[model samples]
Target: ILEEHAFVDELAEREIPVVPASRIDGRTLHSFAGYRFSVFPRRGGRAPELGDSATLEWIGRFIGRIHAVGALTPFQHRPALNPQTFGRDPFDYLRNHGFLPPELAATWASVVEQALEGVARCYERAGELPLLRLHGDCHGGNVLWTPDGPHFVDFDDSRMGPAVQDLWMLLSGERQEMVGQMADVLAGYEDFCDFHPRQLYLVEALRTLRLIHYSAWLAMRWDDPAFPAAFPWFNTQRYWQDRILELREQVALMDEPPLWPV
Candidate 1:
């Protein structure tokens, strides 16, 4: 929590369109009954209309600034979003924890294995890109859009990783559509930050890792009672089937050419 608070403040200092943390009686964190809490000033806005090209470009400018600041220093305490954490560890846990439905277990494993291998190939092709602090989960949900611009929130998922990790989520639709979206985003992103073209290879790979890691995240929380109730759709045979199909798609996509900046 402290790390997240500090990170938000750091980003805010750079004039990034982020909601800053609010200190409680001059302290950003408070502890009571062995629990910790922090507060942030409420910011009002709707989720950005990602379908709008002007919106994507506007978001790209702020993200570019965020990345420029992020690249200046490394995160000291946060985890790195990499194959080990988001891929292998999650796969191992889910496999060993009996989360997979019996009928789909083998198929799920096979698909995930192939997906991870594809992730590896993408990484190898990218070849040791710089890792920096990133807004780890940067979908439109985390951004608030107003006529002025976008404001990023939820630094809890901040981590060390390639800048593209903050990018790929902005893309959607088919390959050509995503390529166009990438061009629109980079139209503003490059104004402030120098983007690595090679990181493009890791987009689908990162997406693959996120998909695998998400299931494990839910499984690890299954015992909380709330998890099972909230995610009843999870751990079902149908869920595993969809996951298998999703991973297969990712594997193929990762093998395809990256978004070559339009």
Candidate 2:
């Protein structure tokens, strides 16, 4: 927690727009009972309109700056976003726990194997790409936009990964549309840091890992009362079926050409 807070503090010092953790008596984390927690000041803003090319570019610049600073030095304690942590471990958890419906269990297992294989191919295609500290979860919800501009929040998922790991989540819609959006983002991003076109291969691969990880995450938190109420549909046959289909789609997507900036 302290390391994450320090990263945020460094970014703030560099003039990057980010909401760093609030200190309590000069401490970033507090121990209460058996739990440790960090506090962040409440910031008011709304999700940026990512559909706008300008907004895409604007956010891209900030993200690029974050990456540029992140590349300066590696995190001594943070983990890397990798197949073992994000892919294999989660899949193994679900398998060992027998979380899948009986009827879909075999099918789910088969497809997940294929999906992981696809992810392997993506890494192979990417070859040796650079790794840096990243937001890890740079989706729309983590970014807040106001009259001034966008400010990043939530570094809880921050880790070491390819720069594209922070950029891919911002893209949506059809391939052609995403290509255009990628172009806009890269235009501004290049102002601060260089982007490797090869990292694009991991877009779908990373997405597949997230899908696998999400199911395990929900399962791990099932005992939490809030999880059951919020995710009533989880652990259902239909949910596993849908996930199977999603992974199947990802397998095909990983085989497709990586998205290039237009």
Number of the top lDDT candidate: 2
Q: List the pairs of residues colliding in candidate 2.
A: none
Candidate 2: list runs displaced more than 4 Å: none
lDDT tens per residue, model 2, 1-262: 6778888999999999998888778888888999998888899899999999999999999999999999998898987898878999999999998789889999999999999999999999898988998999999999999999999998988998889889989999999999999888998899999998989989999999999989999999988999999999999988998999999999999899988631
Give the range of the ten consecutive residues with the poorest summed lDDT in model 2. 253-262
Query: Among these predicted structures, which one has the highest TM-score?
Result: 2
Tell me each candidate's TM-score: 0.96, 0.97
Q: What lDDT does candidate 2 reach at residue 205?
A: 95
lDDT of 2: 0.91
Instruction: Please count the clashing residue pairs in each candidate, in the order shown.
Output: 0, 0
Q: In candidate 1, which residue pairs clash?
A: none
